[model samples]
Target: MKQLFYFGLAQAKACIFPIIIFLTLAVTKIIDIPFLHRYDLILLVCIITQMLMLALKLETMDELKVIGVFHLIGLALEIYKVHMGSWSYPEEAFTKFLGVPLYSGFMYASVASYMCQAWRRLDLKLVKWPPTWIVMFLSAAIYFNFYTHHFILDFRWLLKLLTIILFYHTFVYFTVRKRTYAKPLSLSFILIGFFIWVAENIATFLGAWSYPNQQRQWEIVHFGKVSSWLLLVIVSFLIVAMLKHLKQTKGNLH
Candidate 1:
């Protein structure tokens, strides 16, 4: 029970920035700020919060680097997606480019931040990990499909199959109170994807961004998005895995 509590606590600690951002956005609708736009306020709050986390030693410099990479990657995707009419930020803000608030990139950084923190807190290790080149290739292909699907055939299903084949033998080892537990890496991807899907629902409900269907009336985001999240989680995982040098060796933990 104590182990479980600590495990939960670690997860909560990882999510601190995202939860705070979500709550702040939710309240912005209710509170009338005379001069500041909601989007600008959100940007300010997210930046200050990130600085505080670093200053307080809640996040390390190395972790900040990983988060920074995600921010840029996310921002690039946001520009492409918004251009392709994927979804939209339906608000006016000076910090926005092509309708995406600069702060929107931080949302993706939050996922990377959580993954980095959780890996350290849980002492995670990878077993039977695929080769780096293959993982990188697949990650690139997966990201490319997100954009090319609009112009060409969507290969998400095929890519997902490749992901399962590549990682089927991979295992994630994590510690809880000095007792280590292992799970299939694919399962971890799915579980994380599901949780992100839930978070997405909450984000949409809070008016962070909205789909065309959502603009008419709020409804549950289609379940198919979970697949997209699962792929994204795999992408995030690979980047962190590479950064941490988590490669499988012949002498495996048993």
Candidate 2:
């Protein structure tokens, strides 16, 4: 039974790369197909099912507690942001469970699990504290400046900013040790992320994925695009680096 579970896990992991490639091709219109939304929904369902299987096999009860807490925190932040108009979701895509969509909770839980995985892979002790601090600072600036629609009032913005800072600090506190065995920050990942962000923003502007509250001056919202580029670069690099580290570590163990 244990072997079967692991075998399934391996198969699922193998599928991820192809799934990403397929999605990317479809999104870019290189595939020239309809039913994009249906495919997206299928992907989401698959991801949720995969996470459930992982929960049953990989995570402990205590880890589940942490995941639950992070999910709640992320959901709250998303709700607050959406209510303030930072980013609006399509009503068709979400279920309003607590005046917020069920998808928000799912996103939160997924992010928490992902971050935990990253935390386990990198050893932060080798990296200087400055870069980590700067990353947190950038996270704050990005959250407050670009995502400000989540807080229309200055006071509310400040509160949200504080919450973001607290979350960043908490995440860092838990994940810092992994930073020690840092690998070279991959430029390829950063470039790919930047291009993806740019493409998404362009699609958004073209009404492919709407950002209802993004305001333009002179019919151009370059600032948002730039910030998106930055966010994606940082996020993608971190995620890829961690995944690579995990792969290498596992190979070493084998």
Candidate 3:
């Protein structure tokens, strides 16, 4: 029972930023602010949330660096996806670049923040992790497929197979309270992907960004997006794993 409480608390802490952003979005819709746009308000809220997390020691400097890396990565992807007409930020804001709001990166950073916090709070570790080079290659390929799919054949299924082959034998061990539990690494990716897909639906409902199909009215995001989120989860997991030197025990299954 105590373990469940701690686990829930940790999850809540991980979601603090996302929850705040969601609430801010909901509030902005009802309250008309002449000076501050919704995007600008979101940017401010994210920045303040980040600062508060640091001030309260909820996030460490090393974790902050990881979040920073995700910020740049997510922003680059946003710019490309927007250019490719995959999705779009329709709102105007001073912090936007090429129609991508700066706060959009925080959405990605929040995932890293959750992973880092969960790693620490849950005392998580990887076993039988794959080589860093292979993981890096898979990450790059997964990212590339997001763009190359428009110009060439989509190899996402191939990449997905590679991901499974690389990490199917791996496991993640995490503690809740004094007890420890383990899960297959690939399963963890799928679970997180599902949750992120749900969150994406909520985000779109709140007008964070819109798919081409959603411009007319809000609709449930396609279930197919869960696969994309699964790939992205692997990318985010690899980045966090590399930072923690998890690849050192590549073949140590025990």
Residue 131 C-alpha lDDT in model 3: 85
- Model 1: which ten-residue window has the lowest total lDDT? 245-254
Model 2 residue 32 CA deviation (Å) reads 18
Q: Given candidate 1, what's the lDDT at residue 206?
A: 82
The lDDT of each candidate is 0.89, 0.44, 0.89
TM-score each candidate: 0.94, 0.42, 0.94
Clashes of each: 0, 11, 0
**RMSD, every candidate, angstroms:** 3.1, 10.9, 3.0
Model 3, C-alpha of 29: deviation from truth (Å) = 2.2
Candidate 2 local accuracy as lDDT? 0.44
Q: Which prediction has more favorable TM-score, 2 or 3? A: 3
Tens digits of per-residue lDDT for model 1 on 1-254? Answer: 88889888878977888888888888997896879888899999989999999999989998899999999999999999998888999988889987799999999999998998899888998988889899999999998888898989999999999999999999999997898989999999999999999999988888889988999888889999999999888899899888786433323443
Candidate 2 ranges beyond 4 A from true positions: 1-63, 97-99, 121-209, 213-254
Model 1: per-residue Cα lDDT at residue 82? 90
- Candidate 2 residues 76-191, lDDT tens each? 76677666665554434334543455544544354444434434432222232224454555445544553554345433335334434533422222222222212333332334
